[model samples]
Target: MPRGNPSPKLAITIDPDVHENILAAAAREGMSVSAWMTAAAREALQRRAGLAAVAQWEKQHGRFTTEEMNEARRSVQAQLRTSRTVRRPA
Candidate 1:
């Protein structure tokens, strides 16, 4: 992440059905519900930031070029390959 920040507590209630889905997702990730939720929130923020950057870039330089698209594809493929090579600890 980023620089250190003070921890804060948040509490909220969701529909039982949605809660169950969250529980399942947490279990799949081997994390507590709170941890899973925090991770999800972080990911959402990162995606939003990425989208904003892309929007700004597009506004400044028009749409992405074909070369940029191919470069992005290559980067994604490389990341997939690296991730696949990593094994989860038992």
Candidate 2:
């Protein structure tokens, strides 16, 4: 992994089975166990943040209407289609 991270070390305890699982998963991803844990923790935090933001929005404006949801779906699909790169015949 690229550096520039301030490495602060800490120790924690985990079950042997969980430790083995983490080792296997980290190996599969070609990441150190610490890196895999860091990535997973970051993802978990982001997901929680997104959920909190949506909850706050829903409190301000009631949940989205069906039409609004449909529009969002269409917008995302269009974006996905437009964002794909096309290869040309050489």
Candidate 1 residue spans exceeding 4 A from truth: 1-6, 84-90
lDDT, residue 85, candidate 2: 59
lDDT of 1 by residue, 1-90 (tens): 757896788989899999999999889868888888898899899999999999999999999999999999999999989988996542
Residue-level lDDT of model 2, residues 1-90, one tens digit each, is 757987877698989999999999888768888988888889899989988998899999999889988998899899878766553221
**Roughly what TM-score does model 1 have, to 2 decimal places?**
0.71
- Which residue pairs in candidate 2 have backbone atoms (N, alpha carbon, C) closer than 3 angstroms, thus clashing? none
**Which number leads on TM-score?**
1
Error of 2 at 28 (Å): 0.2
Clashes of each: 0, 0
lDDT winner: 1
RMSD, each candidate, Å? 5.2, 7.1
The runs of at least 3 residues in candidate 2 whose Cα sits more than 4 Å from the true structure, single-residue gaps closed, are: 1-5, 65-90
How well does candidate 2 score on lDDT at residue 90?
Answer: 17
